[model samples]
Target: MPRVVKPKDVRRAEVLDRALALFLERGYENVSLNDLLAVSGTSKGAFYHYFPSKEALVVALAQRSAGEAFEVLRPVFDQPGKNALERLNAGLAASYQVKLGMGVPEPIAAMRSLLMPENQALFRKIVTIWEDLFRPVLTEVITQGVREGVFDTFDPEGVGDMIQGFAASIQDYLVRMFDAADAKSRRKTIDDCVKRLKLYGIATDRILGLPDGATVVLERKQVEAMMTLFMPSRPAGSLP
Candidate 1:
């Protein structure tokens, strides 16, 4: 029989799948183009066809990861009999949960692996991709909230943008928290970050003209859970 050929999309997906496995097993920055070729079983030309550059791979993986994340979150926007407020709450909670679960794990440890100092640029890239991807989802919910009189906003789109900004604001805090030098420093960083999250929750309520404590952007419990889930404390005397 003649050689069977895979469709372009199939081949592209295979490369990405292989890449994701490599990324998860060994952090993204550690995996070189040659490494990808060897593991993905694709030639340099073929890999370049799918990803023009290593950074291109980051973009592709970010898009795919963000897409996967949205799939998990899509249901929250379609729940039966859920009011705008209810959906907003559920949606926010679910989004955090999905992220904490590292569901696609940072649009593909696109978030988790980005934690290392070397992957800072890649981390920033994925964050932008995620914000852009999810902005419309939040806008829709905000618009609906306005329609149902659950949220008070004259410009839901702008509010949606602001929410994305607020969420992105935590990125630096998280980096600092994770990079803390010692147990005491880490504990302080965590506390400060968690407090900032709580404040953001309140700010969200104010933005929507709700009561002082209407929304819970990132609950303390959720923060703690995510911290434990994603970056557990290194064992004493363990390498960083």
Candidate 2:
């Protein structure tokens, strides 16, 4: 007979959700294991059993984040008649939209933390994970575009790197300027950026007629609701 599953997965998932919240509100340096335990409502022993160290937990979180992102875009990429560039751009835009709603302070928050001397190695490992996820999809798109004579370039590997860089930049800029803590400014920034990105496209508009689906607009609403909840501003000149 098959063995029954334990509650460890459930507990670990709970811990991760709390950890992500704390990490979003407070950076990695500010949050301690004690903080994680308190926020997660789990014991130190349980936490340690699941995650031997805070770094280990963070590594798991990073991997999960990247994996989740890939899953969200896989559907778009698999759609018929969508060229590599179309898939690439759609993926980037949709992912950014979801992230904007989800209270991700920055797209590269985990990567940025790794930029420090102590975290550089960890950062590299995470980059490898992301690269593995993006490289094949990007390369295939480039190859297909070139075969169809829609694209001028033919270097799949270089094009893949460019795709990753472009996505990262969009995230960094959107999160910093549009998704800022302030509500009014955040809304304005998001409105402007969304308008511009929709026009210019994220990567290259090789494949024609890609649909936006519900990801961008729905996520934008979520952000608006979050801003309302946290900021709760009133009409101009209303307060003394």
Candidate 3:
């Protein structure tokens, strides 16, 4: 027979899931503990036991969501056979899928909110966690690509930052439009951005002349990593 689960565990998970949903649907300020209680069917005491306050709960929710996302993505980057660039591009694709699946809204909203003076230190801390995770792998890939004559010259760290900035902007746009049900258009924008990114700095010669599946393994690995790595944070801006 299967083992039975505890009620508190079930309640905690339910409360979190419901809270996450509400936070996503309504901006953080708009959603209340009472709202979560109504949706989760849990007592205030139970909610407090799991999450001390609304702000603390939201913070926990953000951290937990981001953590879950990372677990899903880390494997792609960790794959041994994949080359760096292939992983990078594939990561972008996987990221889009995760966003769609998780129903995440515009990330910039969260980023901006997290940047508020009150949250800035924590925001920076989380940003550092993120940078620590992606920077080494990304830098290694770019550095190796340069050494192997696979890429034209660019600073590895700078390139990494550029990629992150670019992806963040694209995600922000995707989420805002997602709320409008303009996913198709949002996807088109992403495709265009990818094409532009490839053209701007990536070696056209390497990609243009490569045989089919040359990049498949790495791309898949990247996509997997990105799926887990990227996710929504606190809502920063007011809703549109």
Per-residue error (Å), model 1, residue 125: 2.6
Please report, as a residue range, the 10-residue window in candidate 1 with the lowest summed lDDT.
Answer: 231-240
Q: Candidate 3 residues 7-77, lDDT tens each?
A: 87676777877875665556555676789889887688877888888767666665665566567666765
The CA lDDT of each predicted structure is 0.76, 0.60, 0.54
lDDT of 1 by residue, 91-143 (tens): 77787777755544444344666666766666667778887887887888888
* Candidate 1 deviation (Cα RMSD): 3.8
TM-score of each: 0.82, 0.60, 0.54
Ranking by lDDT: 1, 2, 3
Task: For candidate 2, write residues 132-226 as lDDT tens digits.
Answer: 88688767766776777555574767866765664444434333442355556665765754554454442334222333431122244543443
When 2 and 3 are scored with lDDT, the better candidate is 2
Model 2: colliding residue pairs: none
Q: In candidate 1, which residue pairs get closer than 3 Å at backbone N, Cα or C atoms, i.e. clash?
A: 102-105, 106-111
Q: Candidate 2, overall lDDT?
A: 0.60
Count of clashing pairs, candidate 3:
9
